[model samples]
Target: MLQRIQTVYMILSILVMGALYMWFPVVEDAAKNVVIDKSEPLVLGLILAPVVLTLISIFNFKKRQHQFVLNRLSIILNFVLLGVFVYRSLKVSGETLVSEKGIGVLLPIISIVFLVLANKAIKRDEDLVKSVDRLR
Candidate 1:
């Protein structure tokens, strides 16, 4: 169930990011003073991280060991990404508190929740594995 939720979250995140990129020029024009450069590596990082993590999650779905590591790593990565988002949000929010730019803040929060849930699911799987091992 949690894995499925995570998958859905990743799909949504990717779609949101793609939409932002597609409409970036218009968004920047509306903001007037601020310009969002989608070409930047940082923007690329934000877009690619979730994609890679999602693929990893899907590939390791049946492989317990890999799923454990991938889920844990995803949680850590989500936290790191959250930090980045918060920092950027703070910097941008300082200029304009109620702007389209503020929408970026929601992405990290959603991603973090999904990643944490994935980690919990992975931990549950690990416990089940240990219990089965003990049965032997």
Candidate 2:
């Protein structure tokens, strides 16, 4: 499991998500104060669900199909998180709610990249195993 490249990618994805959750600010006000972050329940859940899923995928290494499915679900969740951030930043209700978008918004994209790479590696491993089994 740890020897697999996909495992490394999944670990990186987990780290990136952890950083986003702990340190990065989602949005800032005109005064540069953090306006949005994990303090919001929806945002918190969105940010955390992927991390949990990825961890589960990492552990379920023996079941390649299950791992792949989990990663796909994680990717979908990240997209939803990105959509929420975009919507929040774009929402205009007679005031500038999001004065500045922080680096946290991009974290999901990074995580998605890692997850995709991990999925690709997982697929390759699965293919290799299938090919070897055919030799029997």
lDDT tens readout by residue for model 1, 1-136: 3445545554564465455456543223325544445466776576567657666776666775676566566556556655665565555533552356555546655655655665666677678889999999
Clashing pairs in 1: none
Candidate 2 deviant stretches above 4 angstroms:
26-35, 92-100
Most lDDT-accurate candidate? 2
TM-score of each: 0.66, 0.88
Looking at candidate 1, the ten consecutive residues that score lowest on lDDT are 24-33
Model 2, backbone clash pairs (residues 3+ apart or across chains), number: 0
Q: Give the per-residue Cα lDDT of candidate 2 at 111.
A: 97
What's the CA error at residue 97 for candidate 2, in Å?
A: 9.4
Model 2 Cα lDDT, one tens digit per residue, 1-136: 9999999999999999998888765565555555566789999999999999999999999999999999999999999999988787665334444434556679999999999999999999999999999999
lDDT of each: 0.58, 0.87
- The worst-scoring run of ten residues by lDDT in candidate 2 lies at 92-101
Candidate 2's error at 34, in angstroms?
A: 7.5
